[model samples]
Target chain A: MTSILETENSDNQTQKEITLIENILKKTGPSYTKYILGIGSVLTACLTIWLGLFITPKDEHLGNTVRLLYVHPPVAWAALYLAFGTTTLASLLWLWPKTRSYFWDKIAGASAEIGVLYLALTLVTGSIWGRTTWGVWWTWDARLTLTAVLLVLYIAYLAIRQLDGSDKTKANRNAITALFAAIDVPIVHFSVLWWNTLHQTASVLTPGLHLTVPLSMGLTMGLGFLCTTLIWGWMMKVRYDIELLKVVDSEIELQRAIMQRRNEP
Target chain B: MTTNERLLKRRKLRIVIVLAILLVIFGALIYEGLTNSIEYFETASQAVANRQTLGTSDFRIEGNVIGSTIKRKNEETLFSISSGKTVVPVISNGSPPQLFQPGIPVVLVGHFAKGNGPGGTSLLFLSSQIMVKHTNQYIAAHPNRVKIVKN
Candidate 1:
């Protein structure tokens, strides 16, 4: 009788364990969104590499150096997207402070950081490609000049955030600066067309299309954009959580200080 | 409102005004670029063939120098570049690369000039800058070649 009871208890425990596991999986299912993002990113990165290195025809003039266009143009586009996104979000936050103003501030900070990375990559890749084709690594051409200004403005946006002020005030100030800096995007984009400059005109797509690139190339680039946005969004979410925790801790400390002072009196 | 609060509001208003001005400037630039802009890339042969079509238009041209035709008279260097069957005379006022030998690829940036001469009409060459194209294999073969060769 004892043995039969023990076996029944063991079976009951196993069934309970299985149910618990199923519940845990259900709860975490939505949070696994990053995995889907990761898969998409990997697929796009592979496609980009394949199309850029293999599918595109060698230029009659630039030869194999034309491949750099795929990488450089996308980076520049991503930077523009970052700047625009940050400015729009910041503006919305300021205009409607009742709705999660701190959240938008964190997003603006994240976008600016990502924009800096892409902007730097664009400059480096563009210079290298220019050196190969244009004979000069750097030129004071209108497009290049304006882009440099844009980079400086965004860098200043981050610097301003780091300087002393209350979180609310700092967010407002940085948002204003970001909105102003975003003006440089269209200016930089159009400078080549407006001025007699050495920099090439903007391509229909990124870096302008040299004839019609293979459909696979476009697909690959689309993938890259999607992946980058997903990864960036995930990172931003993580950072925002940390910031909120810090804010809560500070508030707790402030309240504790007030209570101690009252007790002493 | 308190004095400090009023001052902050004024500062924010100033920022809004500045941003509006910047937006106007950016809009103007876009309009300008859309109305006036031309981009071209060509080989030396194509540039020679379509000289009249590309008159005064800024373009990039690439070709290899004909081995026995490079000449120097003071600051000016003269050479014939061949891309397939097309040959073009390149007249550059700038210093030529030391490794700029025959059969090596070079890109020139400038416009073709039309001149009336003994040949009825001749193409006058003008290049502001020159770039030498070296293959990865060529560069890898002689890692210290660029260091030793001065242009």
Candidate 2:
């Protein structure tokens, strides 16, 4: 009798464990990695702020406005290069027949959304820095112009991704749009080198092809990139999971409604 | 051709046409950007010669600051910049940059608007901003220790 009772107890415990795992799979609550990323980002951001504002010396030319350097360039790199680059790669993967999957679509869409957010931040911070250093809020210069255009292109790409149609239709439309928008990446990068504009050329990329920032400034910028990347990556993963779950939940509801209609008197 | 193959061919053709249109638009934007650039500023002599053609359009003018021509008035800095043999009067708002000094090349960005003077007649470059032109090379000096390399 005790052996049979122990078996029953073990079966009940296994049932409880299954339910817990199911809840985690459903993503009804925050997960461990989210907490890790959140805490890491917050801590690193505080350190970068301290280093940028306190430890770095004032630039010879820009004075205190030089502090904008630590925040602006790293965010721009994350938005303009890393985020967009990933979107492009994911879009390409989705387009190719052999490797086509919703996984790539989810990544491309998530990265584009996060890219827009960071791109907008880059523009705002760049404008503030411009107003102080160049005595104007904006100029129709090459670098600024292309960056603005890139922001618009990706934003429109995002809007196209949201059209409520068949999954295949929306995926094809988004993939094609993304493939074309990726062309602007090289243009925005080369704009500074090719054009005459009020905005200064890149300083971190020294003429000697070396990074020439002061030690503290470099450290601050490195920290800034790490924190922003971690946070943005977490945001993208959360968003993608939610989107996939929404589709699955909607499908379940559709099947339930169909069954109810068939059983109607 | 079969119905399905014909349809596929038409879709391919449509894709090609759309891509062509996008290409033209992208090309135009890049071309326009190249024409209107950071160095779009004309010299003062060129500004004067082509003032009629440049009516109402804001542009930049590059010139050397004429000696002793920088004057401080309320909320404005009045200066004269010379390019070639011609001199243009400039009235710009905002404090000049740290590197701002007489005899250095500076680009003034603004429109050529009517000036207010005793006669209230001629036009001047009403600049909202000024920039000191420098080279791409960055060289920092300190007593820590250094070796200068020849290029």
Candidate number with greatest DockQ: 2
List where candidate 2 sits over 4 angstroms from the true fold: A1-32, A206-208, B1-39, B43-58, B63-69, B73-76, B80-106, B110-151
Tens-place lDDT per residue, model 1, B66-138, is: 8789998899888878889988888888877544677777767776765663223356567766766543221
Error of 1 at B47 (Å): 18
Q: Which ten residues in a row have the lowest lDDT in candidate 2 chain A?
A: A203-212
Cα lDDT of candidate 2 equals: 0.76
Tens digit per residue, CA lDDT, model 1, A17-129 = 56655664454444566566666557766777787788755543355776775678777877877545665566667657577567687777777877887888889998998
Please tell me the TM-score of chain A for candidate 1: 0.74
Question: What is the Cα-based lDDT of residue A225 in candidate 1?
Answer: 65
TM per model?
0.58, 0.72
The fnat score for candidate 2 comes to 0.17
Candidate 1 falls in which docking quality class?
incorrect
In model 1, the Cα lDDT at residue B94 comes to 84
